[model samples]
Target: MITTLRFTMLFAAALCAAGCGSDDEPAGSGTPGTGATTSSQASSGTGSGSSSGSGGSGSGGTGTGGDVTTTVVVNEISAKGSDWIELGNPGSAAADLGGFGLCDSDATGLCNTGDALRFPEGTELGPGEYLLVLGDQAVEVGPGPHTTCLAEGPSSCFYATWKVSASRGETVFLISPNDHVLNQLEYPMEAAADGQTWGRLPDLTGQGGVTAPTPGAANAAP
Candidate 1:
């Protein structure tokens, strides 16, 4: 991910598989379709509700800082069906995701800094690859990325201090190595609570909106 932005709101009510994401321990045993919910609409550009432009893969994030160029972008946010954060690499080359960090604001307000999650060293995401981080603080981190649940079937999630709200709304921030905001999402509760998920089809640089949950894969409609 890259760039700095004032605001980018993605509806939390977007995509998610029949099993949004695995909330249970391993993979198949976990039950999905019952995580955080989402809202509606994804706005790009300057303001909060503007509806135009794809703005590249690295357009939205938190705070202001130096500019960095990385292909990994926050591709999908599944509030409904299940709760998980999906990141993707759109460039042709693999991205060295080491040291990247992200955080979520209180379901009611801005980020609490202390809840930030820093990627482990040597973390990586191949070109066009998708990584899913389930939203559940109960699971323990294992060998995968920086910190995440054990190498489960496919989706090995990392935990966070906060959970995206389907009723009140939530803001998730992606930070670059330099601590600059790589991409930020602040979707409303209406969007988070309605749609199955809010995601970008065609992968990274597409428009974000309500769609089916295709975690660890490309975004698509049901």
Candidate 2:
């Protein structure tokens, strides 16, 4: 009886050992190596997605650009001829000179207005190009802010006169149609009678030669 009992106990111990080994093999096969492979693939996919997203974000916003500028060079105030307002383009790119204006303190009709000048739409002034807007009868050149000059120039086209009765000198302010103060000149120490030009010549006296512009700045020398 004792021998039989010992034999049964040894068989039971062997069965338990076999069962443990069987359970361990599946745990090894289903887990460690497979789990690592899956994790690595998931990480690689996430990395690729992040990289593509960043690349797309970097390619989204970009434009073409150019510049336009105007300068007033007061050539000569006329005696019998029409008063002249000289316009010049000093920029690299061509600019539309439409919707521009010129004004003086004393204007009749549209002669004195801030919205006086009207160029053809898309009228581009190339670098160093110039145009002369005859300050005719519609434009009464005097002092102060005015808005009718350009609108009336066509009407005053018959007689655009800027006759200044100078007392020593006079001041003429050229306000742009854009409301930009383009040029201002104070003619001093001259005759106080009509006929003399209100501005300094660009070549000789430097008094009325527009604003002596800073290089690279608006109104700068070409």
Candidate 3:
């Protein structure tokens, strides 16, 4: 009877010990939460979004890269013989001169405008090239196709609206069609006279001075 009772006690102790043995690994040993994101998962999601956007159904013609803005400046001016205004391209690229504008004085608009001129269509200027604009009629030169003077230029001809005042020098303005001023200067009264011309000394860089005529060509020392 005593041996049987001891054997039953030992069996009960073994059952308790086996049930209490820990089966858990650790606190952080489980899988990640459903809301958590890994770095690789984030990268993969971004790549998929980009790919889906590129696969959208949209079409268009080839792109021209939009309008290119190039540098074209006033190279020379002449209030004397033929009354020519010269433009120079000092840059290394070709520029479209279409829709460029000029004015003898500051032009507010068409009503109170001084002598203003506009370049004809299809006008172009190349690298290191020169352009000459002449005054023929004694009237104001409005925008394109409104001038009376014919273009005698190789590339294109632009005519001044009114004769440049040699006696009463006024402001000379070079503007784009969008009313953007490219170059402007105040021509002092009697800036050039007696067949002498007012122009840029070294073509594109030097200061303005009275020099010999170099219409449609490089400027030289007077």
Candidate 4:
């Protein structure tokens, strides 16, 4: 009986050791398999970041638009009896002449003067339309299909306070609202005859020549 009891106790001790060893396992022996999944997840995160960066770069390439430029021209000038300057808009769109300036100078290029005559607010020149700016002593030279005027008071005539010399050649400048010179022309003293006017031959885009005084109408043949 004593031998059998000792054998049973030895068997029970061996079973308990086997069960405890299997339950404990090695601390991190199974972690290597899980590490592969973590690495795959890290790779996925990196790809996501790269895609986000690409989208950000695409959003930064949309700031290269075009700029607006003026197309109006100084079509005609008269330094005679009724000192007037004619501005024509041959473009397709109307031009807002408000805040635009006009100055008489002897400079061959752009004229910069502090006493420029600025167009009144709400002044506009429609497409293919002509605007006549008259001087204080200017009067309608002839009669035609031209009767629109922009004046401060209740008058049907638009008059300018500035005057151009009839004997001396001078440069006339058309300035934009931002103080940029739009167009300029230097008239000769010979072209400033009492009853004549210097204008673009074909209206807006032609060579300058002296013609009959057409205050608000198309230039006539010399």
lDDT by residue for model 1 (138-195), tens: 4355323434433431535565545677676666666665555555555556564444
Instruction: Write the candidate numbers in order of decreasing TM-score.
Output: 1, 4, 3, 2
lDDT of each: 0.58, 0.35, 0.54, 0.57
Best prediction by lDDT: 1
Q: How many clashes in each structure?
A: 32, 19, 1, 0
User: Candidate 1: which stretches are off by over 4 Å?
Assistant: 1-65, 106-110, 139-155, 192-195
Local error of candidate 1 at 60, Å? Answer: 15
CA RMSD for every model?
26.4, 23.8, 19.7, 23.2
| TM-score winner, 3 or 4 | 4
lDDT per residue (tens digit) for residues 144-171 in model 3: 3334332443354566656566775654
Compute each candidate's TM-score over C-alphas.
0.62, 0.37, 0.56, 0.57
lDDT of 3 at 179: 44
How would you encode candidate 4's per-residue C-alpha lDDT over 1-222 as one tens digit per residue? 999999999999998887555555776656555542211001112111121111111111122221113455666788876677877777666776666676676333335446566776667767777777765432344211135453321124355556666576666666655555555555666674667888777777665678777755677766
Segments of candidate 4 deviating more than 4 angstroms: 1-68, 106-112, 136-157
